[model samples]
Target: MAIYSAERRRLMEMLHPGRHQVFSEVLSSLGAFMEKEILPLSPKLDAGEASIAKPRKALFEQGMTAIPFPVQYGGLGLPFSVYAMAVEMLGNADASVALSVEIHNAVAEGLLRYGSDGQRKKHLAAVISGKTLASFGLTEPASGSDSSTMATTAEKKGGEYVINGSKMFITNAGEASLYMVFAKTAKGPSCFLVEAPNPGLKFGKDLKKLGMRGSKTSEVIFDGCRVPEGSLVGQEGEGGEYAKEILHGARIVVAALNVGISQIAYDKSIAYAKSRKAFGKPISEFQLIREKIADMKTGIDAGRLMYLYAARIKEMGGDYTSEASQAKVYATEMSLKACDEAIQIHGGYGYTTDDLHRHWRDARLLTIGEGTSEVLRMLISRKELSRAQ
Candidate 1:
């Protein structure tokens, strides 16, 4: 049985109209790739170094990089709707891989929006081809949601700028070839492209996390790391604005990922309920079990619709900060709830180190990363109050 019903299909169609065919095709391709390649590689990557390198290399070898960039940059130039669908499908199979891919795309989008023409020509093509991995360095040990208070400083000295600070919980930190680091400059907060292998650039060991184990998250330290003056991205003092633009779009993508995870959890719970019998009958036949299923399905459907709406608003060139915040907050919380219920439905089996348990653990990270639920609530409230004023 298909998880997406006809009504859901019609809803998506109504929202996207002529865009559905391309979106469906990208989703189908991503679904097949995730099942055949990404999911199978997750266990190996989670195992150790040697095993991890193979899939990481294979992801580049395959055409997965085309999902985000424009055709001029050797990408599929796929619509944001298609990109969201592809990410949702990938997240359903392996969130770690999905996360790694998502960060790379986010960085690419940021560069496209803020990078100079020379910077784009020099960097974007390599990124789209997966020859270069980029990390966004915005969140710090001291600056998670409150970016204005970041302590990272960049000082211009003649023809170069020296950077000094540390970034915590950075995705692809050790593995990335380049980093889009934000630091307080004389003009204000500015972004600079810092290349790896620099003597002053250092990476701390990966922080052991509760979930998303296969993805590398580490701390980056810049001790007087210097880059050419030309490395600055966009206008000086606009780094925060640039970061916000990147994140507004990214929040929706994260929402799509959460929707995918929630759907998977719901499916697993439903299957377990049908197969596990109690009192000489399937647990799915019980009223309480049916109610759990109903709630899970309803939450997933609502979250999915919110994700699509946010994406549509973005594609239409609308200001969707409030909409994106709502989608991300709702979808992530819904996923957490669904995962908890899935674990409950699985009884003792879910508590073990099984796939369902892994899903539950992975689902926890979505709420905290990107932006915390508390922070998102504040953003939504602030926007509403501003509009009222």
Candidate 2:
């Protein structure tokens, strides 16, 4: 089956028929490209035989990263929902590449949302064009996803800021050309755009993972890391708010990503069930198997709708914090269930095969990354409670 399946088409048609056709065509063509070029690399990517940089750069040249930003900063000026859908396509192709690219794009998002015009002109276009690979550096050693407890600090010293601290589990860590670093100032948490090749900036060795092994993850250490005062992206002591805003948008994309993972796993299970024989016939004919398929499809559909709803709200310039968190929590948890069922459908092969079981391994990360389900639930409830009051 095509990566951009009929279900996706029907969903798009339901959303906006004539208006979304262009975006639909773009996604279809991109999906075709990924199936041909990138899908072949997925197994290799998982096994550490291929590099993510080349395929990702090809996507950059395809304007994948450029989709959601304003045209002025070299973006396609498309709605954020379009970009979210594109990420879904990417996730279907390869979760690792999707994860790496989304984190890179998140940095561009920070610049677009909070950076000055000069900063946007200088950094945003490069990131959008993939000329400079970007990394989000908010998660620290002591703080997994909590920005409030980040121990990193930046002190102003004679027209420069000296940063000292380390960030853990940073995606695209060593490979990123630009790092969006958040550290505390006297005021509070602040953000800085630290470029690569700084003498004081160091990267630990790449950390291996259960899945998404294709992408680089490592520790980003800053010891007396001096950057020009201009490196500060926005006002001092507001990085916490900036980080929160960026993550709120990112949660939606993460939802879409998990949906993609679920779709692929479901597709594989269906194909396997049709061929794998049972006591009398193919397992697809079995009632229990049919039930799993139905539930998987339903969950995937619901997850997609949730993210698109949140994405549309965002496009309308409304407050989407609660909606985004809801989508992230629901979609990610749904993905785990879908992927787990897929393994059950495939039975022995799913357990023995790396490529088959990797879906579960990959889906497992979304729950813990970005913001944990527990944390996001609290956030959604807090937002709703405030609204009600």
Candidate 3:
């Protein structure tokens, strides 16, 4: 069965029945492409036997990166929910690719929201169209999720801004052709569109990771990386705000991605339960096994609905920050639980198998990445309290 066949239909029916056929057609085609091209590469990607470049390029050619943007920038002009669903499918196929593509789209989003007309003309189209790949540079060694404490600095020199400091754990670090770099200026936090191959820009070796190894992660160092004044995105000192807004949307997508991971893990567990025999019958017949299966499916459904709810709010142009955080917190933790139950249901095989455990591994990152669950809880509470007041 297709990944988006059943639940996706329900989501589209609830959120956008009028466009259901269009979404089904486009996503079905994309899902077919993923099953053919990306799924086969997942094992190789996990084993370090294949580079992610070819499959990533293939996905880009299929216009996965341009799904939610406006038509003027070569996007499909689809609703954000469609894009969220697409990310879920990608996560089902391969988490690393989903992470890379998600971060890339976030950069496109940043440009759309904050870039000047010239910057948009120069970079946004290329990025969404996948003519150029971009990475976000905000997190630093000392600053994990807290952007206010970032130590990176940019100084005005004549007409150029000279940036200094490093970004840690940057996704697509070495491979990206452009970076949306954030740094402190005399005014405050700022954003710069730094293109690749600058004399002052350098990337550290790719870090060996416990999961999502298919995507590149490294330190991005800026030794006085210089860019023209025009490279600045939005107003100076507003990069922090831009980053927050960008991340709110990203949290929704991250939630979708985790739901995808949970779906895959749940599917695998169900198949395993039906096939693997215990006590002369399929283990799925056991009461405990059935309970785990029920919880896994329920959690996956709840996570999917939560993210889609956040996406709907975003589509309607409402304040979705708290909703986004709630989805991220719930879905990420829910995925971890589902994957763990999947591993438990598989028993010894799950503990030893890379394919089974990798789902858990990949799901593990999101809880810590976008916004840590603890932090998101606080943010959500603060929003609710302020709204009540």
Which candidate leads in lDDT? 3
Local lDDT at 268 for model 3: 94
lDDT of 1: 0.82
Q: Model 2 compared with the native: what TM-score?
A: 0.98
Per-prediction TM-score to the true structure, in the order listed: 0.94, 0.98, 0.99
The all-Cα superposition gives candidate 1 an RMSD in Å to the true structure of: 2.2
Per-residue CA lDDT of candidate 3, range 229-310, in tens?
8999998999999999999999999999999899999999999999999899999999999999999888888989999999
Superposed Cα deviation of residue 385, candidate 3 (Å)? 0.9
The pairs that clash in candidate 1 are: none
TM-score (C-alpha) between model 1 and the true structure: 0.94
What CA RMSD would candidate 2 show? Answer: 0.9
Order of models, best lDDT first: 3, 2, 1
Query: Candidate 3: which stretches are off by over 4 Å?
Result: none
Candidate 2 per-residue lDDT over residues 2-93, each given as its tens digit: 88788787877777667788888877888898898788899999999999989999999988999998888888888888889989988899
In candidate 1, what are the lDDT values of residues 284-319, reduced to their tens digit? 999998998999999988988888888878888888
Error of 3 at 108 (Å): 0.2
